[model samples]
Target: MSSNKVYVVGVGMTKFEKPGARDWDYPDMAREAGTKALEDAGLDYREIQQAYVGYVYGESTAGQRAVYELGMTGLPVVNVNNNCSTGSTALYLATQAIRGGLAECTLALGFEKMQPGSLGSTYDDREQPMMKHLLALAELQEFAMPPAPYMFGAAGKEHQERYGTTNEQFAKVGVKNHRHSVNNPYAQFQDVYTLEEVLASRQVYGPLTKLQCSPTSDGSGAVILASEAFVDQHGLGDQAVEIVGQSMVTDMQSTFDDKSAQSLVGKEMTRKAARDVYEQAGIGPDDIDVIELHDCFSANELLTYEALGLCGEGEAGKLIDNDDTTYGGRWVVNPSGGLISKGHPLGATGLAQCSELTWQLRGTADARQVESAAGSNGVALQHNIGLGGAVVVTAYKKP
Candidate 1:
């Protein structure tokens, strides 16, 4: 099928809150976000030809129920679940529809109403989806902690043993993201902390403090995608953010073959996905001015620097030391605070990243905006990953 240009004409998100902190349910979250997005684009619900809704914890037909709150027009509502990458998976599908000439306008919406505390297996009667990853990790290291932190922390420890990455370096990520969250009104935790404060926060695993981990959140985010023709017809040219490139990759043979902790948690998958997106966009990492990467854990952020080609392997620590990833640096990353501080409502995470990047490119991110976001050569990059595992990398720029 021939491809057509796709643009994000509008984006919106609920202020991420702790699970059970808000009285509203998933449908309400979807409505607020979806309505804002439609309004932002000056489009009516009837204009949307298709919709995709993503959530990890939900009943069957939940997508239909959620979209019904927006409009009962019976448009196709595809439910998506790809672990934490669910949101971007939905966005990826919507992009395909427009690119393939199936739909001119589509909505990608995601939300999660999570249970408080560390994530765990939901069904003991059935085999866990992460069994393969868990088994692979067991071969490389002992499992003494919860699965999530232990896996990522083991990767951090590996980076240390191989490259002398210190706990201080990993802690710096927590500092940078939390500090960035202060300027974002939508972040769940806005209070900043010193390096010592972050390090001293209760340790969940080796070099990982509670501060570095993404909290289970309850929120929703929505984005409206349109074909280039639709954008022109709707007079959305000024606000449209073009999706120059996007790629989603799952686990590879190296994930199990390399027996490396980072590889186990999707290092190579991210690398290949980022490579594909750069090739598709016809731009490299150097052209990016802002980023909204998945920082489910601070360690993953450091490892992703190498995976996304932002830095060489084992040199992520030096990147942090040079302050190259924050304001007044080489790139302003996680300007919306990322999952670390903004909260990780699994399904909502990727759409939140999309929303943040869209706002950045439009020069409307206000206090959380990057100074170089409007640079002629600048583009925004987004990375979202899940441990089962899947990763989506996307590049965006103002039209």
Candidate 2:
């Protein structure tokens, strides 16, 4: 199908914080991020012909309520919830609108005001969305901890047992990300930690330490997308970051049948999404100068390396051992400090990833700037996963 190209002309996000750190609601976070996005794009809210607002814990029509805080122009406001990937799902919808010529401009926004402590089910009356994953985990490991840490920590243990990935390697991710966060003003945990410190930090489950898991966060993120014509009309050439390739995938049979931590945690979905994105963009993993991906747990980040073709199976340990996934390495992964340090606010996570990548491509990442992205290749990649499960992988490049 013929399609108009979609480009991200502006992006904004609230500085992620721990739950109850701020008394503000999701709408308040949404307004701050949305207003900043408009100002970044030099466009008013009225110029946004449509919008997709994403959140996981909120009332019905929360999308409408959040965007209404921006200004009600009667624009279509779609509520989106794909667990943690809600932000990217909303982004994907907005991209479709512009690419399909349905709208010249669109807004993709996400926010969450989460309760403190570990996440819990909001609906006890209905079947859990993650029942399949949970059932598989029950067979593989006992649930002695919160669902997230239990699954992820078990996944880390499985990785170590299978691939000889040591706990030190897992702790290394938290150390690197936290060190990276020292330069990021928006990160919730900015203090740096040593490898020893990370490993010694309170163990949440199995090999997963407190420093390796993403904290419950309250935040919002928004990005403005425009068609080529809109970019030209608005003279947003310098700021625009083209959506070179994007793909979203859901769980398949492997997620249930494999029984391995990798498969149990939507590893196949990440692989499928990344493979398709690479094929569509006509670029391999080596072409990517920077990346912003979901690192809800250090284990997930390690698994993602293999899924995204950064390394071969069982080779992620070596990748981490050599420090190949950080600055001055083959690829700069999670230069925003990642979810481990930057904080993950459910729906806001994906859009926050998008916002960070846009800043990297635009060479405005401040101290976290990826020098390579400002060079000739100028490319960025984003990956977000929701364990129900869905995964979105998007490739971006300077226009």
Candidate 3:
């Protein structure tokens, strides 16, 4: 017997903003995002049988805190924290619950109220969760930059050494994402920059300028998921977007065995996850019309292009140079601006990607909608990864 199919019937998120720009807390963010998602789905809080909330920096039961403020439904709320991928991990759980017949309707919510500047540890007394990853990274190389930048930067540098990808090509990604953000009302940064401007910005790490990095942000995003039966019961076929296929893969031996920074920073994991998702969906990368990828840094975004099989290995630079990753290209990527401009609020980033993809698939993205999305034949792709480490790749199709 096959597992029941799951679908996303509603998705919503608050506009991402700089850390201090918002006068709101996580609960307030959750209240608005969750309420919007509930309204989008035409359902009440009481109708949600379960809730999975994701956050990185919060007290225990933060899930309960966020949801209770939305309404005292007293649902089985589960809190999740999986580094940057927390949002989609929550989403993964909700999809599983519905697919497993444990719940007919579920909510996956993610929120983060982050501090300004580059990320740092909140609790230093205990062992860092990424100590092992750092140890593995040390065996290969070390740089003066912080661990996050060093890992991803080292990966980019290695790609340059091996593939001859230029710093300008990487900057082009920042330019494209920022330009794309100009059409995205939810993006934190809407100002467009020329490729030269992007290249001249303050450097964050090797080949990555400040413009190429995703800033610490404050935001919340949520999605309502339901089973086919629930969709049929509620007559939600038109609003639903089927989770065509999904996969979550962790770091394999290649992360350490290959002794490559790219592998250490999640290239291999993303590769495996994308392959699994495509196989499950019975479709290839060429079938995808639009994408919301995890571009925490431009380097990752370019590397991801090759990892996702959008182009031949080491050809991502060429792909970007040819403008194949933007509008009027093979795929319209990061139409919501991706993390580089959309803002990455740890746990909230993944669900926000979901919101963007659902809108694109439904042809409801307004100004950001891709030309391919007009005929309602759009198939959206999502990629979200967190180092130390897990990667989730999902495919969505119009209902």
lDDT of each: 0.93, 0.91, 0.91
Model 2 TM-score on a 0 to 1 scale: 0.98
Candidate 3 at residue 286, lDDT? 87
RMSD of 1: 0.9
**Model 1 lDDT tens row, 1-399:** 256999999899999999998899999999999998999999999999999999999888888888899999979999999999999999999999999999999999999989999988778998899888988888888886589999999999999999999999999999999999999999999989999999999999888999999999999999999999999998999999999999999999989999899999999999999999999989998989999998999999999999999999899999999999999999998998889999999989999999999988888889987878975555999999998999999999877
lDDT of 3 by residue, 256-300 (tens): 888888998899999999988898888898889999999999999
Query: Once superposed on the true structure, which residue ranges of model 2 sit more than 4 Å away at CA?
Result: none
Alpha-carbon runs more than 4 Å astray in model 3? none
Q: How close is candidate 1 to the true structure, as a TM-score?
A: 0.99
Decide which is better by lDDT, 1 or 2.
Answer: 1
CA lDDT, candidate 2, residue 238: 88
Clashes of 1: 0
Which candidate's lDDT is highest? 1
Query: What's each prediction's TM-score?
Result: 0.99, 0.98, 0.98
